[model samples]
Target: MDVVVLIGRILFALLFLGSGFGHLTQTDAMAAYTASKGVPAAKAGVLVSGVMLIVGGLSVLLGVWADLGSLILLVFVLPAAFLMHAFWKESDAQAKQGEMVHFNKDVALGGAALMLFAFFAHNSDLGLTITGPLFHLG
Candidate 1:
């Protein structure tokens, strides 16, 4: 069970970790794309989000302060889902479909992060325990 948990954590964190690396490495491209989406302070947003994703992903993967990591993910994901993947605002069928898919994916990931936060908040033994003082609920 513990091994399964660790594996799951690694798999789950991979997306954010990879994305963070991309955001940092491809700052100009990412910022330009974000700016096209009308996101203000695109460059800064990319950098901040990149750092958040890296920290959050690492925390969860390492089984240390996962609750806080989950919170960080939730913060980054919710706004990102709405701002970046606004499917409702798209008119073209193909573009709308793609945006919808991305939106759904972000929403699903956000839900997973929320669930992780709840689980860790309860101090459940099903997987990793929250070791960070800030995230400790008890």
Candidate 2:
């Protein structure tokens, strides 16, 4: 379990860090890309990217508030994968035709890792509220 957690942490963390840095350092390109995808500019794209990197990377590495981090990553990645990538239009030949293909894959993988980490780590001495169900009824 510890090893699994560690591996998951590393995998998830690297992805978050890479993504965040890419978006932050390439703000002009990223913003242009986002606008191309119909996302509004004037919103601080670089700031948001930086935040995603810091928050997501830290949470995964420290395993603190990882669930929240995972959830956030999940939210960010899904539409990024489908909407931004146009996944349905891709064939094997065209799949690797653009940067969006890779970005889409990376985001999707990060989202999946986040979800798994959240689910598995839930059993690792973490506080989870169980409501409306009882193993023992008196």
Candidate 3:
């Protein structure tokens, strides 16, 4: 079960890790797309979000301040779901479907982040973490 938990954590972190890398490495291309999506200061947004994802993903991956990491991710994903992938704003059917997928994906990720935060904040057993639940209630 512990191994399974580690595996799940690794898998979940991979997406953000890779995407964050892309955001940094492919800044111009990513920022252009973000601009097209009407994100103001897209380049700055991309850079900040990229750093946020990297920090959050690494924290979660290592179980270092994981509760805080989970919160960081939740913060990133929730508004991004609407600002970046507004399915309702799409006019074309296929575009709407694609946007819906992205939107739902963000929402789902947000929910998962919240769950991880709950587990970490509660000091639940999360296997294979170097150090965990660095954020704690008094």
Candidate 4:
């Protein structure tokens, strides 16, 4: 792999790993935030977020089954970004705009991570296999 790509992978993995660890360590805050968003059973939010962070972050780091991990993150982030952040009209005037922007940026990052999984799908070494060939340059 090119040095740049390697660096990119490491950087991306680190971001997710750091975020995951943060989520694990700050479960109480996350749960409160989830409740503020009206998520059902806010107490469960901590466990859910922690698992997503740990599993998804690890997959990205190991470069194995990362696509699935990215997909999982995609599912989680899109809803949280939209519903919780209320990037639409639900935001309050005082700080709603800032929150919306932040959530939107997170959504973009999640998308980039998903795309990275596609770009590096060929590097699986953790017994996670795709069913078909990934390229068609011929």
Candidate 5:
């Protein structure tokens, strides 16, 4: 059961980790897309979110301050979902559908992160538990 929980955490963290890498590696492309979405300081947003995702993902993966990581993810995801995936504002059917899918995914991920924070932040029995600085090292 503990192994399963650890695996689950790793799987969940992978999404953010990959995305963070993308943001770092593809800053110019991401910043252009962000600017298209009318985001202020698009480059800065991409860079900051990239750092947040990397830090948050690593924390969750290691079960170290995962609650804080979850909170960080929630902060990044919630606003991003609305700002970036405004499906209702799209006129083209295909674009609308794509945006809707992204919006839904973002919302779901945000909810999952929130649930992780609520559960694992206080309850140690349900998921991976870390003692001291590093769980695997200890």
Candidate 6:
């Protein structure tokens, strides 16, 4: 793999890795935030999302089953964009702008996940994988 790809993967994985750790360690705070967004069983949601983020982040970072990992990330990100960052529902200008930024960031992350999924979908000539591609659509 190119050094750039490795670096990008590390950088991308760090975002989720840190957030996932935070979710588990600060469950109370994260659950409160999720509950504020009207998520039912907010604590459960936080815990589930936390595990998902950690698993996916590790998979991508390690380039093992990256296709599946990217799909997991895509699944997590798309819904989160709508469910948590519904900027259109915000009335206050500041809140709306804040939500919009988060929403856009999630959307962009989703897109990146898709790109990674495609890159890993075709064959197992992966530059960095040990036992990979594992499962893909192509």
**Model 4, residue 30: what's the lDDT?**
80
State the lDDT of candidate 5 residue by residue for 46-99, as single tens digits.
999999999999888988777888888888899999999999999999999999
**Model 5 scores what on Cα lDDT?**
0.86
* Candidates, ranked, lDDT: 3, 6, 1, 5, 4, 2
**lDDT, candidate 2, 1-138, per-residue tens:** 666666766776787788788787787887777777666652375568567776767666666666666665666676566656764565666654674666768676765855655564455443332221111113
Clashes of each: 0, 0, 0, 0, 0, 0
lDDT of 3 by residue, 13-80 (tens): 99999989999999999999999999999999999999989999998888888889889988999989
RMSD over all Cα atoms, model 4: 4.5
Q: Please, what are the lDDT tens digits per residue for candidate 1 over residues 5-97?
A: 789889999999999999999999999999999999999999999999999998888878788888899899989999999999999999999
Q: Pull out the clashing pairs in model 2.
A: none
Global CA lDDT computed for model 4: 0.66
lDDT of 4 by residue, 29-113 (tens): 8878878877887767667766786776666556556666666666667776776677565546767777778788778977886
Error of 3 at 59 (Å): 0.7
RMSD, every candidate, angstroms:
1.9, 6.3, 1.4, 4.5, 4.3, 1.2
- TM-score result, candidate 5: 0.91
Give per-residue CA lDDT, model 6, range 1-138, as digits (tens).
567777988999999999889989999999999999998999999999999899999999998788888898898899999999999999999999999999999999999999998888876577766456866665
- CA displacement after TM-score superposition, residue 37 of candidate 3 (Å): 1.1
RMSD of 2: 6.3
TM-score for each candidate, following the candidate numbering: 0.92, 0.67, 0.94, 0.75, 0.91, 0.95
Tell me the whole-model lDDT of each prediction, alpha carbons only: 0.88, 0.62, 0.90, 0.66, 0.86, 0.89
- How far residue 63's Cα lies from its native spot in candidate 4, in Å, is 1.1
Residue 28 Cα positional deviation in candidate 6, in Å, after optimal superposition: 0.7
Q: Where is the poorest 10-residue window by lDDT in model 4?
A: 129-138
